[model samples]
Target: MALLHRAELRPTKLELLAAWLPGRAWFGGEAGADLERVAAYRFDDPAGEVGIETLLVRAGAGPIHQVPLTYRGAPLDGAEPWLVGTCEHSVLGRRWVYDACGDPVYAAALASAILADTGQAEEYFEVDGRREGRAPSMAITVEGAHRADVPQIRSIDRVEDGDPVRIVTESVELAVVRRVGAHTDLPGSRLAGTWANQPTPLPLAYASLR
Candidate 1:
């Protein structure tokens, strides 16, 4: 389960994305277009140190976009290039945000989801020491079977951020689709999801063992 705080964020998630998205090569919307949050889903980090969330957003009259992000208390070493920017959390103070494609924890989680069928995490609102169940804004399905062992991804071998953000490791290769609704028939296990305004499940990411 993932615990969520009701604290405020300085430069809300959309604000940060607005300033960063245009710079990405795969971003197809206007540079100054307003982005709307369609929906989101989270993946639990087994260690419980990092927060992994994927946001589905869209600009005016543009295609929905998929952006996977990771939140950390401190800067990720050697990840300066992938840094989206920093935001201050009311409850957690300073947060180091990065593109999930650069986070090993995200890579491991994605691989596990594809190869081991571990779906999205269950979320709860922590209020006054009590946990309240919170329904996920988005739902996902994994096209794979349950597995006992998944390769441990401690570091990333390469990251190629394009239309499909490619994360490569010694044991696996993952392609994170940047634009929603643009599904392709790719080999290997895949992860698909659906949200508001989108009823059909669309490919979000694909992974293959190396």
Candidate 2:
């Protein structure tokens, strides 16, 4: 299993966003804004070092937006072409870029994690979100590669508040939820409320990951 120290992971997260976010369609900025560390958490990865981080940032007069990101640092030399973007870290003084899900090892590890948590197979999972629209969102391709084994549903849940579901697979755990104001039905509606790990009486559903 590969895990990253919290210290090692945080700076890398900022470096990646600084490099990648400015180019994204959803990013509204002339240049990357200053990113502040709000809250962050970690996940396990059987294949490589995986870090899940959520950042709050103020960009060009827009309200604070939550930028969820994942990081892997296990020498993906040939995989550079698959990265979303790359930048030189002022601290690390090295270049870091976005993850590549097209790689089989990365994809398989992600699929295995989703299946272990949801009891669904790979072929049934579908990556659907407003951010994804017709094209699969970058996060989906990165975090959802292993979802091929899970059921195809609008979303998955482990809490009643409907915020988002966090699941652990192999060694990696991911916070799964729909983009705000994206889908109006099914799993999306289930996320309308805040998410809590404790128990609740909310009605939940399970669909194929097709």
**Against the hidden reference, what TM-scores do the models get?**
0.96, 0.41
Please report the candidate that would top lDDT against the real structure: 1
Top-scoring candidate (TM-score)? 1
Candidate 2 lDDT over 81-103, as tens digits, reads 44654434443334344432323
Q: What is the C-alpha lDDT of each candidate?
A: 0.90, 0.35
Model 2 stretches with alpha carbons more than 4 Å out:
1-12, 29-32, 48-70, 74-78, 81-96, 100-181, 184-208
lDDT (Cα, tens digit) per residue for candidate 1, span 139-169: 8998765567888899999998797888999
Task: For residue 21, give model 1's deviation from the true position in Å.
Answer: 0.3
How does candidate 2 score on lDDT?
0.35
